[model samples]
Target chain A: MTIKILGTGCPKCKQTVDIVNKAVAKLGADIKVEKVEDIIKIMEYNVISTPVVVVDESVKIKGRVPTMSEITALIQAS
Target chain B: MFDWLIYFSDWLIYDVSGLSEGSRLGTALSFFVYDVIKILILLFLISFIMGIVNVYFPVEKLRNYLNSRKLYGLEYLFSAIFGAITPFCSCSSVPLFIGFVQGGIPLGVTFSFLITSPLVNEIALALFLGMFGWKVTLIYAITGILLGTFGGFILGKLDLKDWLTDWVKDIMAKTYEKGDTVTADSINFIKELPLISREAWHIVKGVLLYIIIGIGIGAAMHGYVPENFFEQYLGGGQWWTVPAAVIIAVPMYANAAAIVPVIQVLVVKGVPLGTAIAFMMSTVGLSLPEATLLKKVMTFKLISVFFLVVTVFIVASGYLFNLVL
Candidate 1:
């Protein structure tokens, strides 16, 4: 599984990344977490909001500063 | 007052002449070069400082404390002062605003902080004093504080307290956990300064256009704005001019440091310094974008009250300036 966090280096994006990391850890998932900070590439994923969580090529969440549990559930379910 | 005009006219011609000297292209190049240098330096300093504050300051604790009480009157005054210290811009300030409402801080008090936080501050005051003079800076500071205080107070009194968006309240209930106060482990202050300085430079570079636009507007106002318009319309002689100025300022967004040059021009051009200041304060403090951002968290009535209270204070300050200054 691949988890990607998209943002422009804002605190909220960072928080999302952190949450996703912990969630992946707890789930013991074979996931590679990637962070994308480039604005153009983020838009390519059809996301207009920063701090987006993308699983594989599909967007899981956009424009929110999500919590740890939320990220965990979303990741495990994915 | 009339005598001051002759002196101002003489000064204006002197500045314009200096700007116009040399081949037109050469002069324009030099002006752009100088502007770029200055803006780069200023922006770097401001953003770096803001970054340092973001990284180190106890912002969350203070924000939480401010929201913990419904001390509307004193909170307004506190919010004005506190807003100056917090480095949140129009965009970055929203999440904290969500934090404010979640902590049960009154809408009016939060608005006070929101109004003052963007419009006036130490960095801006320093720049104003450096570019203009202390007297103008003093007037700007006083007016800014008055706007925040009175705006908050009046908004608190409005009966539309329950007008916040349901999503805001719902979101607060779900994910409003506090961050750990582990700032001691963060980078040391001395080490952070250089990093902050660099970022501030970046910001200055990015927003140089805002400064130029502000000054360019001032230059035109100085050169134009018709000498008799102020006395005929917005001067101390007119009662409605104060509110009119406030209304005019709302739709526009003018950064406080950038607006000084224009305010100076408007003041010299026979626009009552008070009315001009009111216009400046209103635009800077209660900008349309800022209000729109608030809409994400607040309902329409609360937002309307936010605008109205700030406008009332700005108009009052305009009248006050005419009487005092």
Candidate 2:
């Protein structure tokens, strides 16, 4: 499964990346994490703020950072 | 109404039954505790609500819509208003500015958006309401919006595209090479209650320290600063205080959330509302750090012009408020 994290490299976005990466590592799941920073790309999802996570093709989160537990649950759901 | 808060804080911070309860230290402790709670609650509640609202207004769509607008004034106004929701620090804002300029939105509209980002944000609004009440927040927000709208329109009319970095200016030159919009893996916000809660939690964690420190400073100042020290000198009647406030604040770097309480102290100590707000806006809107960071995407001339315009208006705003409010 592909996990997309949307951010503009702001501090919150960076934190989300770290947590999501850790969650992916701990789960030992075959998942791809993509960081979307381009404005043209991020807005296509109708996201105004950064640090959003997308599980597969669905936007699971936007605008706030998620904890490792939340990240794991999101990955499992998708 | 807040006596219980003060008393509770006094009991916690010092000898509650002692004569020192009426002393400066005691008063400062009480003020700090009362204000800290009030500000944090306001910050958390308002930030959560704003986060929810932001989901509805993505920046990319806003840019495309602005590009399509033939009405320059309306476009600028809309862009300026968008600043209220586009929650990016100055560092991230430059990228968005580049995106808007390349996306065929007018430079003025993009500039308005950039300028408004610091001025009309939830942080600033919450702090203003927490310190000075709704009236000042409304005025400050309106002034910020007007500054962005008018400043951008005039700059747009000047056609200063060449002032941007050659690369950024060339993006405008290559305007017709627009890329097709990409679709995202999307989920409905309504079904994402957990995500929403996480978002709120994140905001509270991010800002809690700033709120405490700011309130702490305000409380201490209210309690300990010598009486008539600020009011006698920096008070509303001082002709030069407003301008000086802006000048002093322009170099410091702090978000609106962290600095509001300090500004509150300044106002309470007899500094005029206009001067205090001018300091707030200048510090948040025209910091040296922000200017230094923007150098990556903008040319010296454009940066100078941007700074000059924002500073002049902010200083003027301070004086106007002092005179009228």
Best by lDDT: 2
Stretches of candidate 1 off by over 4 Å are: A1-78, B1-55, B67-73, B121-127, B172-176, B182-184, B216-236, B254-259
TM-score of predicted structure 1: 0.67
Error of 1 at B52 (Å): 4.6
How close to the true structure is residue B16 of candidate 1, measured as C-alpha lDDT? Answer: 49
iRMS of each prediction in angstroms? 10.5, 5.6
What RMSD, rounded to one decimal, does every model reach?
A: 9.5, 4.1
TM-score of each: 0.67, 0.83
lDDT of 2: 0.75
- TM-score of structure candidate 2: 0.83
**Which TM-score does chain B of candidate 2 obtain?**
0.88
- Give the alpha carbon lDDT tens digit for every residue of B1-325 in model 1: 1244434433444464454445444444444444334434444555565566655554555666675666646878987777765654565455556656656667777777777877675446544554446698787886687677777666767845578787766655664455334334656778756645654554565456767776566555644577766565545457777788778767767465566566666666567777777877776777777677668667888788777766777787888888887
Per-residue lDDT over A1-78 for candidate 2, one digit per residue giving the tens place of the 0 to 100 score: 998988767788898899999999999999999998765576565444456788886777655677788889988876
